[model samples]
Target: MEHIYLLALVGGGLIGLSATLLLYTLGRIAGICGITFSLFMPQITDKKWRITFILGLVSGAFLIHLLTPIAIPAAPTDNIYLLIIAGLLVGFGTQLGNGCTSGHGICGIARKSPRSIIATITFMAIGFITVFVLRHIWGVI
Candidate 1:
């Protein structure tokens, strides 16, 4: 139980460190959605760094999953169409909000950006409502 807490602490610290480093070195926000969205844009001149950043994210997670005793949680449902719809909804929400949780909740709030703060609040509120609807109201989960 204590090890789980330790793992979470270390993981969170690493995330903060990486976000800080990315901002300091590249003058860019460590927003996963924005990074991924920009990856497909042909006109973006800094594709190399973006590719490297994304690869680092993937490899880092793989390494942690491989090395750690922690078991990654399974998704609630295995329905492919439902999963696809959920993903699309999330992507649309991110676009509408201009950033995802890591951007608005972590980096944006840390930087004290008003828009990010509001967006993060809205994100959390909607997330709570969605979970409630899925689990309690509709019993979907």
Candidate 2:
């Protein structure tokens, strides 16, 4: 239990450090959605860094899984349709919120952006309600 907390603290600190570094070096928020969206835009001049950042994220996870004893959990649902719908909903939510949790909860909040703060609160509340409804009311997980 103590180890979990320590790992979380270290992970959070790394996230903050990365966000700060990105903001300081690139004058851009380390928003994953924004970075991903930039990839589809041929006109975006700075795709290289975005690609590298995304690659780092993927490779880092793989490296951690290989190096650490921690066992990464699989997806909760194996249904392709459910997965697709969930992905679509998440994408839509990100679009509507103008950012994902990491962007709003971490970088945006760190920068004291009111929109990000509100967005984070709203999503967190909704997420809590969703889990309650799914787990308790609907008896689904």
TM-score of each: 0.90, 0.92
lDDT of 2 by residue, 3-42 (tens): 9899999988998898999889988899998899779878
lDDT for model 2 comes to 0.89
lDDT of 1 by residue, 5-120 (tens): 99889988999999999999999999999888887778877888989999999999988879977677786789788799999988888877879988888899999999999999
Model 1: weakest 10-residue lDDT segment is 68-77
What lDDT does candidate 2 reach at residue 52? 96
Model 2: residues with Cα > 4 Å off, grouped in runs: none
